[model samples]
Target: MELETIRETYQSGRVVLINKPLQWTSFDVVNKIRWHLTRALQIKKIKVGHAGTLDPLADGLLIVCIGRATKMIEAIQDAPKEYLAAIDLGATTPSYDLETEIEQEYPVEHITEDLVIETLKGFKGEQMQMPPAFSAKKVNGKPAYEYARKNIDVTLKSKKVFFHEIDLQYFEPKHLKVRINCSKGTYIRSFAHDLGQKLNSGAYLQGLTRTAIGQFTLKDAWTLDQYIDKINRLNKYKVGEL
Candidate 1:
């Protein structure tokens, strides 16, 4: 439990893949898992690192590398991801999701299932998008989220992203469920935000769950507690014991 003890026994750069829990920052989970690993093995600290960062508001597969496996993080992030997201119409927000306050609202009387069908077809393509300022993306040497916190306006440049496929599951006038297969940097929040813009109706992400990332998926991910316990259980085994 002491810092020095951890430094002594913990190795650095091991790869772990975990399913992040809702409301816990990636770092919080990392540190908690670190504690679990040390306790299980009766060691100080094991070198552990994580792959892609998932927003606390989102939950899904997060690839982690412990010890030398840490080198694979970038490779993992480069892979595409799939998501099942819900877009709530008739409202708009600064951050595009539940992260910020609702900034505007629109009438939904004119929205229809037919319109939803037509609009979804239009989103299937390569396009340029402005990353949300409330995101972790860096701008001018500082995180855009930091700038947003200080109420400073940040200019974000548009970047190309592809939506390989978007299947409409359910579409009500005010709510829509969609399955999206997109590139690495794609933000479903931004996608929903823009969809509202194109339709001239305000919208925000009501809910989101990452289904797949590259070859990994939620179904294949270890729940947070399960993974932490795994580390504890791992130490009970001997080297070359697998």
Candidate 2:
């Protein structure tokens, strides 16, 4: 793909797949790409938006819409998502993932392979799920995380979500790894919290990597560095040059 072609495509509107890095929020990826695109094309501003939000502790495919393609954001966000997650047994956290420190611990000695498999089966199909308190979901015009940061308690309602698949990839006495295929509003963090209660032991999301969004897979996505380097090369090219 040529530099000019990439710029022109984005100018006309295109969907870009980015493999988001850990510790960087979804907005971080959007801002980085938007900055590079404007510089490469010498545009003062260009509309850029992300289709879905991924937590800072999570890494994986993020669909970015450029120019007029931003209009598809709501539709794209409604698509199903796939994730590979690691859950650490015997402990729980306020935020449900590593984003928060462990607040409690429980015995995992009774957790076994059969028990884990059974639990996985239980989560399959449709159910009501509560979003994590530390989430982007809005609460009375303000984000839930904002209220949480102020130590204010807010009641978040449960939303209906479907888990099409839950494949167990690995299991141990203290940890379990699984690939989950679920609906749009599903929150793995809250799932982790619920899983602990089901097993009568505590659990928290130890790791997570989003592998797919609708038909877009992480394998077909570009890393942030890759996008940046390509943009740099494009910026070096002069007018009328390839």
Misplaced by over 4 Å in model 1 are 1-15, 42-45, 235-242
Give one digit per residue, the lDDT tens place, for model 2 in 69-149: 999999998989999999999998888988778888899999999998998899999989998888888999999999887
Q: Candidate 2: how large is its RMSD?
A: 2.8
lDDT of 1 by residue, 1-242 (tens): 44343333345445555778789888888788767766765666566666677788988777776656667778988888889998999999989999898988998888888887788888888988788888989898888999998899989888999888999899888999999998888878899998887777888988888888788778877888877665565635443331
Candidate 1, overall lDDT?
0.79
lDDT of each: 0.79, 0.89
Residues forming the 10-long window of minimal summed lDDT in candidate 2: 233-242
**RMSD to native, candidate 1:** 3.9
What is the model-wide C-alpha lDDT for candidate 2?
Answer: 0.89
